[model samples]
Target chain A: MISVSMTVNGKAVSAKIDPRTLLVQFLRENLLLTGTHVGCDTSQCGACVVHVDGKAIKSCTTLAATCDGASVVTIEGLAHDGVLHPMQEAFRENHGLQCGFCTPGMIMSAIDIVNRKGHDLDEHTIREELEGNICRCTGYHNIVKSVAAGAHAMAGSK
Target chain B: MYAFAYQRPTTVRQVQSALGKHEDAKILAGGQTLLPTMKQRLASPSAVIDLGHVAGLSGIEKKGRNIVIGAMARHAEVATSEVVREAIPALAALAGGIGDPAVRNRGTIGGSVANNDPSADYPAALLALGATIVTNKRKIAADDFFQGMFTTALEEGEIITKVSFPVPAKAAYVKFPNPASRYAMVGVFVSKKGSDVKVAVTGASNEGVFRAAGLEAALKGKFNPKAVEGVAVDGSNFIADIHGSADYRANLVSVMTKRAVTKALGK
Candidate 1:
C-alpha cells in the first residue's frame, strides 16, 4: 500500500491505498463519492471524468497514487449550502438526463468545456467539445442545450 | 490491474536508477495508454515508475529553428501553447485533434510517440517534420526512432526526454478518423521546407507510419493538390481491420494526401 494525499471537493483527504487503485475506485469505495459513476471501466466512456489540478481527466484510468498532492473535484463538489451549481441547475431545468447514470460525468465534463471554451458556446462547439462524454439517452439535444445554458448561467453567476 | 510497486521519481537519474533496479518496470508517462491496458490486465509489469514528479520533463519552448517539446508535456498543453501554435500551427492543430479534451488533458506527446500506435497522429507529424527524439542516452531521428506498430527504437532503461521539430515552410495533416474511437483510419501529414517535400502516411500501413516516397516525389516536383492525383497507393501492405479494408485505407491515403497538400497550400 502507498500513502496518497489529495484535496478532494475542497477538503484535504489522505489514505493508504493499493498501488493499483484507480482514482474512480478510490473516490467511490474509499471516500464514498459515488456520484462519479463508472459507466465503462475503459477510458472510452467519460462517466469517470473529473477535474484534477484545474484540468479535466478521466478518473477511471488515473491511478490514485499518481494524483498525490493534487486537487481533485467531482460532481459532488459542485454545490454549496444546498444550492446547485449553475451547470447542475441548467441540467435539471433543461432535462439533460434520462436514466441519470452518466449525469455526474456529463455535468463534470460540461463545466470543463465551459472552463476551457468560455461561456458563449455555440452548437457546433458544444457538440465538438463533448466528444469525450457519451449520452445514451435524451439524444443529446437537451444536454447540448443545458451546456450552453449552463455556460451562460455560470458567466452570469460570476 | 496487477499489484505492483510504485515509485514517483523526481529526477531523470532517479528514474534511470529505478529502471535499472527493476528489470520488468514500466515507465508511466501520462497513463493515457498504460493505465487502461493495465486495467484490462493486458500489461502487468513488476514495478510502475511514475514520471509525473520529474521536474524538467514537461514544457514547450522554441530553440533556435526548432520547437523543443519536453517528453511529459500533455497533448492539451501542446495544443493550447502559444509558442507551438505560432511556430507550427499544424502541429498544434494535430495535437488538438488527438483523442478528446479529457484525453488530451492527460495524454503526453512522449507517451504517444514512444508507443508508436499505428493510428496515432504524432508519428506522421514527426516523420513529415523530420523531428528528432531526444533520449537520456542519445538523440535519434524520427525516421530511425519508430520501428513498427507498438514498437520504437528506445532501448530498455532508456527514457525519452524531449522531441525537437524543425519548423517547415508549409505543413498540414488530414485524417479520416474512425467515428467511434476517433483514431485515424488513414492520416496523412505533408510538409514542404525549402526544396524538400515530405509525405508521411499513418494508420493505413501494417509496417507502421511510413513515408510515401511516391507522393513525396510528386509533391517535390510540384507542390500542389494536382501533384498527388497521379501518385498510386498500393494497399497490398496496408492493415485490414474491421474498421476498414486495406483497399479502402489505400484510397483514403490518396484522398487524405490530396487534402493535406491542399490544406498545406492554405486553399
Candidate 2:
C-alpha cells in the first residue's frame, strides 16, 4: 500500500491505498465522493471526468498515487454556500438530463469547456468538445443546449 | 489492474535505478494508455514507475531551428503553446485534434510516440517532419525510431527525454478518423523542407506508420494536390478491419494525401 495525499474539492485528504487503486475508485470508495460517475471503465467515456490541477481528466484511468499533491474538484465541489454553481443551475433549467447518470460528468466537463474555450460556447463547439463524453441515452441535443447555457451562466456568475 | 509496487521517481537516474531494481517494470508517463491497458489486464507489470514527480522533463522551447518538447509535456500544452503554434502550427493543430480535451490534458507526446499506436497522430507528424527522438542513452532519427506496430527502437530501461522537430517550410496533416474512436483511419502528414519533400502515412498501414515513397516522389516533382492524384496506392499492404477495408483505406490514402498536400500548400 502507498500513502497518498491530495486536496479534494478544497479539503486536504490523505489515505493508504493499494497501488492499483484508480482515482475514481479512491474518490467514490475511499472518500465516498460518488458524484463522479464511472459510466465506462475505459478512458473513452467522460463520465469519470474531474478537474485535477485545474484541468479535466478521466479519473477511471488515473491512478490515485499519480495524483498525489494535486487538487481535484468533482461535481460535489461545484456548489458553494448551499447555492448551486451556475453550470449546475443551467443544467437543471435546461433539462439537460434524463436518467441522470451522465449528468455529473457532463456538468464537470461543461465547466471545463467554459474554462478553456470561454463562456460564449456555440452548439458546434460544445458538440465537438464533447467527443470524449458518450451519452448512451442519446440525449446529446439537450446536453449541447445545457452546456451553451451553462457557459454563459458561468460567465455571468463570475 | 493487478497488484504491483508503485514508485514515483523524481529524476532520470532514480527512474533508471527503479527500472534496474524491479523485474517487469513499466514506466508510467501520463497513464492515458497504460492505465486503461492495465485495467483490461492486457498489461500487468510487477512495478509501475510513475514519472509525474520527475523534474526537468516537462517544457516546450525553441532550441535553434527545432522545437524541443519534453517527453512529459502534455498534448494540451503542445496544442496551446505559443512557441509550438508559431513555429509549426501544423504540429499544434495535430495536437489539438488528438483524442479530446480531457485526454489531451493527460496524454503526452512522449507517451504517444513511445507507444507508437498505429492510429496515433504524432508518429505521422514526427516521420514527415524528420523529428529526433532523444532518449536517455542516444538520439534516434524518427525513421529509425519506429520499428513496427506498437513497436519502437527504444531499448529496455532507455526512457525518452524529449523530441526535437525541425520546423518545415510548409506542412499540414489531414486525417480520415474512425467515427467511433476518433483514431486516424488514414492520416497523411505532408511537409516540405527546401527541395526535399516528405509524406508520412499513418493508421492505414499494416506495418504501422510509414513514409509513402511513391507519394513523396510525386510531391517532390510537383508540390501540389494534382501531383498525388495520379499516383496509385496499393491496398495489399494496408490494414483491413471492420472500420475499413484494405481497398477502402487505399482510396483514403490517396484522398487524404491529396487533401494533406492541399492543406500544406495553404490552398
Clashes of each: 0, 0
**Residue B123, model 2, lDDT:** 98
Q: Point out the worst 10-residue segment of candidate 2 chain B by lDDT.
A: B228-237
Q: How do the residues A79-141 of candidate 1 rate in per-residue lDDT, one tens digit apiece?
A: 999999999999999999999888888898899999999999999999999899898988899
Error of 2 at A46 (Å): 0.7
lDDT at residue A158 of model 2 (Cα atoms): 75
Residue-level error in angstroms, candidate 2, position B13: 0.8
CAPRI quality level assigned to candidate 2 from its DockQ score:
high
lDDT of 1 by residue, B64-161 (tens): 99999999999999999999999899999999999989999999999999999999999999999999999999999999998989999999889999
RMSD of each: 0.7, 0.9
Name the lDDT of candidate 1. 0.94
**Candidate 1 wrongly placed segments (more than 4 Å):** none
Supply candidate 1's per-residue lDDT for B210: 95
lDDT value, residue A48 of candidate 2? 92
